[model samples]
Target: MKAYLDLLQDVYDNGVGKDDRTGTGTRSVFGRQLRCNLSEGFPLLTTKKVFLRGIIHELLWFVRGDTNIKYLVDNNVGIWNEWPFQNYLNAQDLGNLEKHSCEWEERLDAFVIRIQKDQDFAAKWGELGPVYGKQWRNFSGIDQLDWVINEIKQNPTSRRLIVSAWNPAEIEEMAKAGLPPCHTLFQFYVSHDNKLSCQLYQRSADLFLGVPFNIASYALLTMMVAQVCDLELGDFVHTYGDVHIYNNHENQVLEQLSRAPKSLPTMSINPNVKSLFDFTFEDFELLNYQPESAIKAPVAV
Candidate 1:
C-alpha cells in the first residue's frame, strides 16, 4: 500500500488549501491516479485497520439495489448514518451544527436506533435518494450491472463495458439530496490472456477516510466479475479528481504514514455464487489480516 501512503504525502506537500462543502477545509490535489495488482494481494490498508465488515455489507447493499440505510444499520454498519442524521437535524431547524454538540450526538444516536427499530421512520429518513444502488440498478430504466456482466462474457474485446452513476439530469437534485455518487464511473477491459481489469473514476475522494474502502470495494467488484466470467484477475486502477485530506485529520494521517505497512491481506469468495446479484455479506472473508491499531479520525459529512 505504498501507493496510498505516497498519495497522502503528495497531497500534504503539494496540494493547495481550500474550503469544501463540509467546511472542514482541505489541502487538495486534482487528477491523481493509483493502480493495484489483484494478483499481488488484496489492496486493503494495513497501516491502519479498515472495517472490512462495513465495506462488505455496504457493497452488498448497493448490489441489492437498496437505497435505504436500514440494511446497513441492521448489519452493524454505521458508516452512512451521518448524512441522514444531518438531514433530520436540518428538518428540525437546528442552527450552528458546524461541530456536532453533545445534544446533537445524543439525538443522532436515538435517530439511528429508531431507524433500526421503527420501519416507518426508516422508510422516511433512512433512504439516500437516487444514490449508488439506485443508479447502478435502475439508471434510466436500464440495469447497468447486468448489462456490463453480459457484455464481458459475450464480447470480451468490446470497449463499451462501462457503468456510470453520474446522471446529469439528477445533479441539481443531488445538490440538496444529502447524498451523491463520488465514485462516478468505472470501465472494464479484457486482456488477450482472459484476464479482467477495471478502472474507476472518482470525482471527489476523501483520502484519509474513504479511499481505502473505495479501493477494496472496487477490487472486490473486479474479482467477482472475473469469477463469474471465468477469467483471471488483473489490475484495479483508481483515478481521482479533487483528492484531499481534511485538515482535522492531519495528525492521524501523519501517524498512519509513520507506521510501516504490513503484508497485504487476501480475500476469499464463495465459488458457488454465479451471479453478481447473488453475493451476500456472508460469502466474503478476509484472510491473514494482521494490522496496526485503527486510527480514529472524524469523517467530513
Candidate 2:
C-alpha cells in the first residue's frame, strides 16, 4: 500500500491541473504503473477501509454479464448508483440540480430507493448500457472472459489472452447512461512454473477514489483465474493512463497518506469454486484487514 500512497504523493506534488468531463478539476499525470506480488498478500489498501462488499459484488455482477444496477443496489452496493440516477435525472429534465448538493443527494437517494423497490424502473433506468460486463463477456458476440480462461487452460504460452472493454461502437450510448470503461484492457500471462500474471492497461484512473478498488478487484480476479486454471499466483501489474486525483479529493488524499499502511490482508477464496462465473459473494473473505477509518471523498462523476 506504500506504493499506492507513493503514487498519490507523486501526483500531488508533480501533476498538472487539467479539465475533466465531470467539471471537477484534476491533478493529472500521463502514465504510471504499480506492480504487486500476489504471493505476498492481497493488495487491498490498508490506509483506508475500502468497501470490500461493494467490490466483490460489483466484480461478480461484471462476471455474470449484468449491465443493470439492480443487482448492485439490491445487494446494498451504491458505487454505480450515481451514474444511472444522474442519467435518469437528465432524461426527466432534472439535470440542473448541482451535483453533490443537498438537493442532488436527496434526489439521488430517492432514485436508488425507486430502483430497489420497482423492478420495471430499475430495468429501464439502471442499465449501465454495455459497459464492462457486456464488453468482457460479449464483445460483439465473443465471450472474451470464457475465451481467455479457456486459452489460459489450453495454451499456457499464448500471448493473445486479452479481454477489452473499449467498444467504440457503443461508447456514445455508454456515456449517455453511464461511464465508458476507465480500466479498458487487460491481458494474462503464464510463467514456466504455472504462475498466472495479469497486466491491466487502464486508460483513465481516479487515483484517490477508484484506483484502490481497481487494484484489489484485479488481484482477486487473477487469484480466481489462477485457481480455476490450476496455476500459481503471479504479480498483478497495473498500468495507468490519465491517472489523476480530483481536486475536491486532495485533502482526503493527504489524510490517507498521513496514515501508516498496515500489513496487507489475505483474501481467502473457497477452493472448491473452480468456475469463475459460479462464484458467490460469500465465497470470498478478507482476513486480518485492520486499517484506519475510511477517508471519504466526493467522486468525480
Candidate 3:
C-alpha cells in the first residue's frame, strides 16, 4: 500500500491546480499507474478504513446490470447517494440552497430515506442513467461483461478481452442524472502461467476517496473472473488520466498520510461459485483488515 500512499503524496506535492465541473477545485496530475499483485494480499487502503461492504455491494450491483441507487441505499451503501441527490435537488429547482449547508444535508438524508423505503420514488428519481452497470452489461446492446467472461474462458490467448463503460453517445444522458464513468475501460490479459491479469484505464480519478475503492473493486473483479475461468490470480494495474484530490479533502488526506499503513487484508471468496454473475454479498469476506479510524470527506458533487 506504500505505492498508493506515495501517489497521494506525489499528487499533493506536485499536482497543478485546476477547477472541476463540480465547482470544487483540485490539485490534478496526469498519467499515473498502480499495480497490485492479487496473490500478495488485497490492496485495500490501510491508512484509513474503507467501506468494503459498500464496494462489494456496488460491484455486485454493477455485475447485476442495475443502474438504480435503490439497491445501494437498501444495502446501506451511501457512496452513490450524493450524485443522485444533487441531481434531484437541481431538477426539483431546489438548487438555491447551498450544497454543503445543513439544510441541504437534511434534504439529502430525506432523499435517501425515500429511495430506501419508496420503490416508486426510487424508480423515478434514483436512476443513475446508463452508468457503469448499464454500459458494462448493455453497451449499445452488447453484453460486454458476459462476452468478456466467455471470451476469457474460450480464448484466453486473445488480446481483445476488453470491457468499456465510456459511451460517448450517452455521456450527456449519464451526466444528467448521475456521473460520467471515471474507471472507463479495462482489458484482461492471460499469462502462460494460467494467471489472469486486468488493467483499468480510468479517465478521471478522485485520488483520496474514489481510487481506493477502484483498486479494490477491480482486484476483486479480477479474482472473481479468474475463479470462474479456472485461472490463477495475477496483478491489477490501474492506469489513470486526470487523477486529482479535491481541495476540501486535503486535510483528510494529510490525516490519512500521517498514519502508518497496517498489513494488507486477505479477501476470501466462496470457491464453490463457478460463475461470475452468481456471486452474492455473503460469498465474500475480508479477513484481518485492522486499520485506523475512518476520516470523513465530502464528495465534490
Candidate 4:
C-alpha cells in the first residue's frame, strides 16, 4: 500500500494541471505504473475504504459474460452508473436546457426513473456496450478466454495470453456516440515456473475516482486466472496512459497519502473452483481489511 501511496504523491508533486472534459480540471501525468505481488495478499487500498462488494460483483459480471448494468445496479454497485447515465442524458431531448447545467443531477435522476419505467431505456442503459466482458469473452472472432486457457494447457510458456479491450471498430462507434473506452487493453504473462502475471494497459485512468477499483478488479482477475491455470499468482502490473487527479478529489488523495496503511487484506477463493469461468461471487472472501473512513469524491462524468 505504500507503493500505492507513493504513486499518488508523485503525481500530485509533479503532475501538470489542465482543464478536462468535465470542466472540473485535473492534475495529470502520463506513463505511471504500479505493481503488486498477489503472493503477499490482496492489493486493496487500505488508506481509505474501498467498495469491495462493487469490485467483486463487477468482476463477477465480467466473468459471467454479462454486458448489462442491471446486475451492477441490482447489487448496489454504482461504478458503471455514470457512463450509461451520461450517455442517456446526451441522447435526451432537453428542450432548450443547457446540456451541462446544474440541472444535470435532476435530469440524471429523471433518466434513471425513465429507465426503470421504459423497457427500451433499460435495455439501452443497462447494456454494457463493448465493455470488458465482450472483449474478454468474444473479441471480434477471437475468444480470448478460450485461447488463454488453451495456451495455458498446451504451451504454458507463451506470452500471447492477452485480452484486448480496445476494438477499433467499437471505439469508432463509441466515439461517434461521444463515449470512449478508458481501460483499453490487458496482457498476461506466464513464467516457466508456472507463475501467472497480469499487466493492464489503461489508456485513460481517472486516478482519484477509478484507479483504486481498477487495481482491485485486475488483481482479482489475475488471481482467478492463476487459480484456474494451476499456477502461482505473481505480480499484478498496472500501466497507465493518461492518469489524472480530479480537482475535487485532490484533498481526499492527499489525505489518503498521509494515512499509514494497515496490513494487506487476504482474499480467499474457493479451493474447489478450478476454472476461472466457473467462479461465482459466492466463491470469494475478504479477510482482515481494516481501513480509515471513506473520503467521498464527486465523479466527473
lDDT of 3 by residue, 1-301 (tens): 9999999999999999999998899999999999999999999988898999999999999999999999999999999988888878888899778977899989988999999889899998999999999999999999999999999999999999999999999999999888889999999999999999999999999999999999999999999999999999999999999999999999998998899888999999999999889999999999999988899998887
lDDT of 4 by residue, 56-148 (tens): 999988877677777777676767776677666556754345544779768766766665567777787667576677777888877788788
Worst 10 residues of 1 by lDDT: 171-180
Q: Score each candidate by Cα lDDT.
A: 0.91, 0.93, 0.94, 0.81
**Which should have the higher lDDT, number 1 or number 4?**
1
Please give the range of 10 consecutive residues that has the lowest summed lDDT in model 3. 91-100
Candidate 2, residues 94-144, lDDT tens digits: the string is 888898889898999999999999999988999989899999999999999
CA-only RMSD, every prediction: 1.0, 0.8, 0.9, 2.4
Better of 1 and 3 by lDDT: 3
Global lDDT for candidate 4?
Answer: 0.81
Clashes (N, CA, C under 3 Å) per candidate: 0, 0, 0, 0
Error of 2 at 180 (Å): 1.1
Query: Residue 103 deviation, candidate 2, in Å?
Result: 2.4
Better-scoring candidate (TM-score), 1 or 4: 1
lDDT of 2 at 120: 93
